[model samples]
Target chain A: MSNILEVRGLKVMYGKSIAIHDINISVPEGGIVTLIGSNGAGKSTTLNACLGTVPATEGKILFAGEDITHASTAERVRRGLVLAPEGRHLFPYLSVQKNLLLGATQRSDKEGIQRDMEFCFELFPILKDRLKQKAGTMSGGQQQMLAIARGIMANPKLLCLDEPSLGLAPAVIDDIGNKIREINQSKGTSILLVEQNVHLAFGAASYCYTLQVGEMVAEGSVEEIRNNDVVKKAYFGG
Target chain B: MGVIPNIMVNALVLASMYILASLGFAFIFNMLGSVNLAHGAFYMLAAYITYYLCAKAGLNNWVAMLLAAIVLAAIGIVMERFVFRPFQTEFDRVVMVSVALMTMLQQLAVQVSGSQTISIPAYGNGVLDLGFMTLTNEKLITFLVGLILLIITLYIVYRTKLGMQMEAISQDRLGAALQGIQVNKVAMLVCGMGFALAAVAGAMMGAYQQVSSNMGDNINVRILMLVMLAGAGSMNGILITGFLMALLDSVCPIIWDSYTASAIACSAVVVLLLIRPKGFFGHEM
Candidate 1:
């Protein structure tokens, strides 16, 4: 598979404090790549920088061989890079259908948008049933599902998800994990999964990277990372 | 019969103007989360521009009103780009800039117009007798114009793609940007629309009352009260509260002394705000 995203020596700072430092990662097209780390490990920061939400202090980000280091967030989305942020930032007051419609704001293809809306509804039938209901009134699990469905409406080439299983019950997490795998296998949509749940990450990702304090500590196949002592000690707590 | 008809006409007229002004303020406040203290100045500038174009520049009053709206909208775009854009999150700085702009506009108007009350020629000069009552043609025209504009504005807000983008931004700015909605462009459009709406209100009010340098001061207070009473970021609430305020404005004078009417209105808003904090239909509660 070809590399669809490349981050070279990226450094992101917030005022005087450094949020991420000298991080490099490459994601190949059509696979699940997970970045597993503890809290304050700069996983979310790296994802945000890739999406152009946070300005990088130095280095470059290339999407599909195109430099996107200085691109605006909206421009990044236009180029098919979409982020399903950590907090499931759905428009709380808006209806589920409206929230999904907003995801296709950049695309003018009304037919394609409509098809994608149906695809989302097919994936999560609950959303279709609650299409007119406000998003804030939904359950946490349903909101998570809606968030992923909203991302799919953008018709992204690469979807960056930040902790999709953050606070979900184990059963819900399993369902989400299966859906992520199904999305990757069926739709050929590449995913950059930033997650703390090692089991879920291991289950969903083929390639995995371990991040510690803004640096890539380990990068290998899932089986290799599972065998790494550091991964076992920190995440699996052996 | 006479008192009821008079009150109904008064309420409708006042409601029309209040909705016009409040909607403009609501647009800026909801989307950009800025107070836009210079909004009233924009309104005053529109009245003065209409005055200048009609009285001095030899333009038709209707044409001047349209021109004034366009001109103020252009100024609004420029201000959004240069003034409000840089001061996006700095609330106090934005407020200071707006206040300074308001002061400059007031001073400029005073210098140009010399503190005199000048009225734009009425759009209509006659009166219509409706069975038991009489209505000035100007009042009827103003009320109809306001209603038409309000319907158009509401249509643009609810039935257009731009409207969806505005609602999305107001709800979640970062999320909207992530979805490829241009924040800066939307902000500019919003500012232009806001100022244009205020300008229309100013021009119409100039015809109803007199255009003067300090005319904006009184309307500015009323605009603020309407927005607060409606609560920020609630379009439906704005529509509801606008009429409520207009009703208060029309009826209070009949129930209380003229001097105490505004005070009573203020007290009612305060009491309601204390009880609900987020107005009647606001989502933020």
Candidate 2:
């Protein structure tokens, strides 16, 4: 399968300090890829670089066939490259429906947007009843679901989610994991999930990459990553 | 007019005018997260422009007010693009730039019109009898027009797609950008709208009362109080607080001397702020 996203030798610096260096990642079309790392591992920096929020000091980010390293965040989003950022950054004071509508800002097709709204309701039925409720008032798990649903509303070719399972309960994490897989299987949308939750990441992603500090340490199938002694010991707690 | 009715009318008229002027100031404060110290200058400039158009340029008072709003809006867009955008997020530097802008505008006003006080020709002639009270046609027109504009402004804010975008940006700028809402473009439009609203209020007040180069200096304090007491991220609160502020302005003088009334009113606001630091209905910015 052709890769939907390719990040080659990506390096990001904040002033004199390097956030991430010499990093490469790819997500195949219709596949789920995850980057897993602990705190201070530069996972978010890498994700922000691909999203064009932070400037990449070196390297190229190619979306489908286009070199988008120099593109603006809005341009990247317009081309179906979307990021549901970490911390569940939903508009807290806004109603859930307005939050959902904001996600589809790039599109104008009323029918397509309506269809997507129904799809979201189907995926997370609780969201339907809470449509008029303020987003901030929702529970953590529901907020995380809304974040993913918001990203899906963008109708992205590649949806990059940062830490969807962070602070969610075990059962909620499992449900979110299933939804990530369901989205890929049903919608054929590519996903690039960045998580510190090893179990959730391993369950959702077919291919995985592990980063330590600012550099990639391993890249393999989920099965291969699960068996690797060093990665297993460090991340899996085995 | 009875004393009670006169006081009530004064409060209502003052509330409407201040609410119109403060809406723009509130928008810039919430959306840009910067204090536009030059906002009062925009108001002052509008009054002067309306005065010139009506008195010297042979235009109708209403037409001149509209023209003043347009001119100030154009200047606002230019200032947002060239002056404000670059210094955004640097609060101190932005304040300095706005203060500089205020001084320049004030100086220009003085050079053009000097220290002499001027007023626009009344929008309406004769008096309107409202049973218990009689009001000059000019005051009634100012009140009615100000109230209508305020309604239209609120409607645009609450019932429009562009308004939704503005709300999203004010809440979370990065989140708005992720949705492909162009921040700079929206910011420019907001600046233009803000100045236009201030212009209308200034022009209306010019006809109702008098205009001087330093008039903005006095109104600036009231604008600041309105926004600060309303807190951040809450536009609806401005309406309530605007009326409350006007009530204080109107009623306080009747009970005490002007100086004592000013002191008592400010002290009351300071006390209320102490009780609810986030104003009546606002979250942390």
Give the true-contact fraction for every prediction, in order.
0.80, 0.65
lDDT of 1 by residue, B1-285 (tens): 688888888888878877887777788778877788888888999999998899999999999999999998898899889877888787898789999999999999999889667899998989899989999899899889889989988998899989989988888888887888898899899888878888988998898888988778867877887788777677877788888888888899998996699789888888988998867777751
- How many times do residue backbones clash in model 2? 0
Could you tell me which residue pairs clash in candidate 1?
none
TM-score against truth, every candidate: 0.96, 0.93
lDDT of 2 by residue, A1-62 (tens): 78899999999999999989999998999999999988989999998999888999999999
lDDT of 2 by residue, B1-285 (tens): 398888878888988989888888888788878888989889999999999999999899999999999999998899888777887788898899989999999999999998888999888999888887898887788889989988888887899878888999888888888887888898899889989999998998887878888778767878888778888887888888888988998999999998899788888889989998878868742
Model 1 residue runs over 4 Å out of place are: A233-238, B254-257
Let me know the DockQ for model 2. 0.55
Candidate 2: which docking quality band?
medium
Clashes of each: 0, 0
Model 2 residue runs over 4 Å out of place are: A229-238, B255-258, B283-285
